[model samples]
Target: MSIHVVLVHPEIHWNTGNAGRTCLATGATLHLIEPLGFSLDEAQVKRAGLDYWEHVDVRVWPSWEAFEAELPRLGQPYFFSTKATQLFWDAPLAPVEGTVLVFGRETGGLPAELHERYADRFVSLPILSERVRSLNLSTTVAIAVYEVLRQQR
Candidate 1:
């Protein structure tokens, strides 16, 4: 099974690193869209990946347009956001080989345009507490990836 975890305009190096680790663990490819806040060579990123960074099948794209152009060939695309009404569990998150999970920046869930463009593709993890805003980027990635894996089995 092939899974693709995409982080668009990701800001935190640590979250990226942790996401990379999760990707490596699950044999999923990691794709990052640029205008990133931190450099990929930073120590914090490597520290979070914990020596597994080198093994990660990571790809970096210059812009969203660049990545969007190749999205068709990647897999079935799913945009994750807290604003979505559809619960992730209710979505057709199966056939792991044909899934590409896209997440937005930590500060902002997803670009307003993406929500408009792929309105039906968006899915959200449930948040019971009103106090909690959203899940951490890395944590969200891990949960989504594992859900895909679970369906595969």
Candidate 2:
């Protein structure tokens, strides 16, 4: 079994590409939920991912609903958000097989309906500065993915 990094309605190709790189490094599968803002063939994405883009275990979904329909009941599903009260470190994450880490778009975070549905699973990375609203989408994914990896080790 492998960990999964899910990006729902991602708007930037570079972020997705960088996330793919992180997934590749961490042995996690990358799932993209459309409609995407940029085409996967875009040069910018390739530039960001370098030569490793093709090596990513990427799966593209038509929509969030479609992705959810086929979601595997791995270890546990954790949603990363800036609005969540629980910190990622505070979550009871273990390095179990098939752990799923879900992230949202760069501009809007996760949909409101998803928040309502998976309220308990929501986790946040601590931001001490009031000047920052949220971290970059790719950065958040990397942090969350490593957290799971660390716990499991």
Candidate 1: Cα lDDT at 21? 89
Per-residue lDDT tens digits for candidate 2, residues 93-118, read 66455688899999999999999999
lDDT of each: 0.90, 0.87
Instruction: Residues 21-138, candidate 1: write the lDDT tens digits.
Output: 8999999999999989888775755555568788999999999999999988878889999999999999888664479999999998779999999999999999999999999999
Decoy 2 TM-score against native? 0.92
**Highest lDDT scorer:** 1
Candidate 1 lDDT at 26 equals 94
lDDT of 1 at 144: 98
